[model samples]
Target: MTTGPSQQATFAGMPTPLYSGSPSRLLAWLDCPRRYRMQYLDRPRPAARAQRAHTSVGIATHNALRDFWDLPLAQRTPAGVAELVRSSWIDVGFRDPEQSAAWRLRVRDAVTDYLRRSDRERQPVGVERSVSLKTEQIAITGRVDRLDDRDGELVVVDYKTGRQVPTDDDARTSLPLALYAVASARMFRRACHRVELHHVPSGTVAVHEHTDDSLSRKVAEAESIAADLRRADAEFAQVGVESPRFEPRPSAICGWCDFRAHCPEGQRMGPEKSDWAGLEPAGYESAAAGTALP
Candidate 1:
């Protein structure tokens, strides 16, 4: 008597899981593992002020310079770039009107300073170009701010929005710039050994020389990070959301954390949520609605 398979229950019935990856995920891991868990793993909704005014101003400056470089050679003048900045102006997270105005002036001055220091005579070989580098198990993607081929040698140029000028060691250790050099070399079919950090605010250049060994090391580090992410995702799938507890690292910088109010560690540190003064109404309206008024 051939009997068809009887109805039997599967062992520990559970649905499959979901996982996603992004460049910012790796960056968060580098910053703090618990922070990374809260951000990427838990994916909590923010209920507090996230970023500082300086960060906003820096982003605006970087975007302005990027747009300026995107312009045609005829429009590469300082005046043209300033106009671009004004056109693309965003006032999302400023403390107050006065602070916003001061930041705008600072951005304009930085752009002007950058243009003056940059070589107008020599046009960029490439600008705002996106490239990707891949290994057997990892892929790293980013945009190059500027790529210049001077005197038959390739150079990677990155604009710095911070007030302080970085030193040569800082430039050497910068992962993004090194990655750009590696990607640009592969894209252009040339050797890119020189990486530069152009500090617009200080109008100075921090140069670093890269060797094949160093570039290989950076790639290996990135691959290792990717492997860590894969392992984390696998563990999450097996154990579910309750698998790993999300811990928060509270510091003075917690005031700038987007998930500060949601973080137990952050709340226990001090000053629950009184740091939103002078911020734009639009930026804090949601946060205010989520948390009680102070």
Candidate 2:
């Protein structure tokens, strides 16, 4: 006997569990199906190139920010931030030691300035907190950079170390931020409707206030993406690369594709960028941002 398309998706006795993914995973599919297949489904995944200096900077900045809250109140000073940056720095993926050291000092200052404007006296609700949001269709999990309680309302704050200073529209449209806000609210049993993108380099906070309807809409949007992923993932399991579901979507940003080394179609789009191509000063355009998968 043959099963219907829906029934074929089922295992011996029950339907498959809800799709598990992060906002990044969904975005990866939207960015390029071939990339999603490689990064998520392909066994013996292709090795991505060495990290860029800019990514190192971003990593260091995030680590320093996360560790800062753990320090004793008195040690949360600018000098302390410098110490954390030094301790958490990843020296890989740079032009040279000199370039690495220069960027290190710049990041130190950026974090220091950003923290100066923060209210150290008021402790945050959470830092680098892992939260999950689940619906009947999808189970989403991610780590939020920071969670704040302003006037008893929960806020989701995502730190951006990239060149672009995010705007209000970015905050409004961000799926990850919206999902985090929903998860934080549900986890803490508080109303969380505000999301802020804290652009660390420029110390700018782009804010957006989401309504209940808006958040619900975002979740529905996520569910839609997950449904597609569910089907593609199943197809990949059957035929792998032969799965027409995963297509190569190339663009000029091929220069920044970490998986470009494996994708002939992408390589044909443009020349690969230098390992340090994305290491420009934060004030400069984040080359990665140009083609950054939304």
Candidate 3:
């Protein structure tokens, strides 16, 4: 039997598939390829550690803020925010019920103060709205905490509950924020160049304005990361867990990594952080907003 064309040759000319992921996924690969593989590619997916107290606080605050916009305009008061926080509270990862209750009240007060600065009567263009961006090389998706229309221009707002008060540099350097801006602009068919990091705990707002060149640079950076991920993912498909591309990058972050239990190298870096440790002053990082994957 004579074959017209070999199967290998038939498929050899096909272009590599575009990588599909959220901004968080691209960052995961950069943070630790092994963790990314385990989190996203592992068929039986390793179980992550329990949520930390800070994450609970962040999620609850985000939830309350999201629901706050849904309330009747007259009910968007301090009392309403207090009630929302109470209802949205996640009572987990705390040392005890007393600690949880205390933090709950703290979050309530902080969120109330944060919203006080906003024009409650003017509804935001989007609240926790999901947005996406696509290029020839990759597809990225993420959710924006808030989207604002100021002077006919769209702005991306990301809420931060961490102790690290964001700065203009933080806003400018954030890959997720930049991606959200690009996605929001393309989705709404409007110009979006401004991004803000709102530190809800302290009610501090950090802003950055991106130029066309800057936004393009960010997209290129994402494409570069996605290209690397695509190769790693393909290698995983061929050899599974034995793929050499998935290597651990141990650092101080390993202490707080959710998959520390599963990564021997990460476990060796230091003692894993206690579930409630994040609520401690020393444990604060910029991760209080939680992961922004779709």
Candidate 4:
């Protein structure tokens, strides 16, 4: 006897299992169901294009930041950061070698400047830390850029290298950041209610202090997202790409999406951006960091 799309997962007697993945996965599903299907459901996942220049920059910066704390306390200086950036640099998706090289130097300086204001000697509670939280319906996991124990309180820090310099409102309502804080608190047996978005290029930090009520709301929000994902996932399991639930959500950022190539709706929305379109603004570099790209 065959099963229907929703009922195919169980033996009709046992309890359903928890859904587990990084927070990015949940966000991806929420962001666009078609992209999510391509990214996570396809039997042979479609090949995504090579990383764009901005993503390359983000990755290099994140790697350098993650590796910084591994260096000796004496070597965790501006020079050290420069060295890390240079060594971790990814030369990809740039217009040419010259452009790639120029951005490399610019990113190195940005990292150096950002590190100058940081107390490099103080060891972080966790760097590039993997934390997870579970509820009856879902299990969410993600890696944090940095976890700080400031005066015995835990703080979640996420590094952003994109053109968007995070605002305080960005910190206050970030689902991933809130989930990370809650997971860190649970894993470390400490209270963690503060989340921060650290824009590396501009040396700007956006912070939000969460109360118990707010945290509960965020968790509930995640649960709601997960519920939608759960139903869609079940449908995908049975119908594959033919599932009606897996449809595209077109928006301005569709051009930036990794799976946009497979989406006709996305293609009609606008011309695709060049791989290197996000690396600079029209006139000044630093001032335009957060101006153009989404």
Candidate 5:
């Protein structure tokens, strides 16, 4: 008897699946398979202004904050972090100097607020730690923002620069956080049961508690999604003609898609422009807005 394609095998034997069924990629798969095929599979070079800006700001912000956390407790001063932010800052996507200035101020404020609010009692155990786990045939990989040890237990901390605060439920359901928890626990040889989202804008922390079973379930779900994506790709390859199997799923976010001007369905959806930072307040909104259109 022959075995059908297992979930694990779908992502097996690669240097790490270049694309996992991350929440981001899942939306891409849902929005327009062609876009996913081009970006993920074909690995096309990005040429759009908005895309470059969004990616640049997020990278700059994440890196600056990570560097701050890497500083010694005595040196984790507001001035130091602000300087880091300035050095890492990138102005790729902003249309005007005023808009760019406004974002820089916002980032400065967020970093100041985070430094003041933190306890500074303990240091981060890891910053930007990349981890991977396999289930059946699928391999999932992600870089955690930060991981800290508190009272002998591991904590997964994610930094958010958006305007709104995520709820405890949002943290619990987050795939990256869950994957981080799983990988951290194994890496540290201890249990990691708490996940926190540090909302820099609101200066508040959202916390979620996870059971071992729940973490396992999240990994299983990710592996299952990876399996589905692999199957879809295979089916598309067999039929050819740009995969009719993958159709455009339009939504409120069509207006904000960077690919909107280029996508047929996106163009028909009526184009509307929005700033990357100002447009989406939450992770879900941002992810939805990133989808490719018709």
Candidate 6:
């Protein structure tokens, strides 16, 4: 006798479990099911690669920005920002101390310039705010970098320190941003349709406004993904690593995949990138630090 994913619950006479995870988990499944299984389902999850230079820089920059908001009104200055950057800096994955130090200074200046246009007097409603969304199919949680009350409505702001500058289309198509906006609106009881991608390096701000209809569509999209994930998780529960559903999706992204060492299929796609490769001018493989799975 064979059991299907949805029917597996019937064998134990228990209701199907609702998939509970962050938006990242859902996206991970989409990025590559094999990698997703290794990351989330494998017993004693396979070790990922060492942190790359760009990830370190991205983390430091995000930390500095996060801490900057916590400072006293008077402490919000260029000097204070620089000190935050220095304190938050991670010395890992660099070519050497010289390269690390130089990037540290570059990050400092970029953050300072990014902050200059802000209204320092007005504190944000939430910095690194955790938000969650629940549907009948799934429960998703994630943290928003910044949340602001502009006029009576809330705005979702995500910082980008990567080589790729976000565009209005990026904001419009982003599942996470739309989900964040929906969660914020529900939590604060205010309209939150506007989302912004703030690129710290070039000081470029990409904006998008979501309507109720558009947000509904995004929610539907999430629900669909979750439905697929529920089945995948069920299949994994039965077969473990032998499940045929987890197939490697090889692409250029394989070069930067953290789990490349364990995935021969992905490894064949390209040579593994060096730890410092992401720090180069053309190194756009990784997204923001601590965010991208690959």
Candidate 3: clashing pairs of residues? none
Across 180-289, the per-residue lDDT of candidate 6 in tens digits comes to: 99999988889999999998887889999999999999989998988888778778878887888899999888999989999999989978988888763733222232
Residue-pair clashes, model 4: 0
lDDT of 2 by residue, 1-294 (tens): 223222234567675577888999999999999988888888889898888877998999999999989999888887788899999999988889998887888787778877877887778999999999989889999999999999999999999987677999999999999999999999999999999999988778999999999999999999999999988887877777898999989877678888999999999887888878776554532222212111
**Runs of candidate 3 exceeding 4 Å displacement:** 1-15, 280-294
Clashes of each: 1, 0, 0, 0, 7, 0
Give RMSD (Å) of candidate 1 vs. truth: 11.1
* Superior by TM-score: candidate 4 or candidate 5: 4
Q: Which runs in model 1 stand beyond 4 Å of their true positions?
A: 1-23, 43-51, 70-75, 249-252, 268-294
Per-candidate TM-scores read 0.76, 0.91, 0.91, 0.92, 0.80, 0.91
Q: How displaced is residue 4 in candidate 6, in Å?
A: 14
Flag regions of model 5 displaced more than 4 Å: 1-23, 30-32, 43-49, 52-57, 239-241, 276-294
lDDT value, residue 173 of candidate 4: 87
- Per-residue lDDT of candidate 1, residues 1-294 (tens digit): 111111122244432222234456666767655666666655353444556666666677778876775677776665676677677666766767776776576567567656765666576787777877766666667877788997787899887765456889988987878778888888888999899988766667899999999999977777677777766655654564564533455676565566665677766666643332423332211111112111
Question: Candidate 6: where is the Cα deviation over 4 Å?
Answer: 1-15, 280-294
lDDT of 3 at 195: 98
Candidate 3: C-alpha RMSD after superposition: 6.5
Error of 5 at 3 (Å): 18
Of the candidates numbered 1 and 3, which has the greater TM-score value? 3
lDDT, candidate 3, 108-185, per-residue tens: 777776777788877899999999898988778889999999999999999998767899999999999999999999
Rank list by lDDT: 2, 6, 3, 4, 5, 1
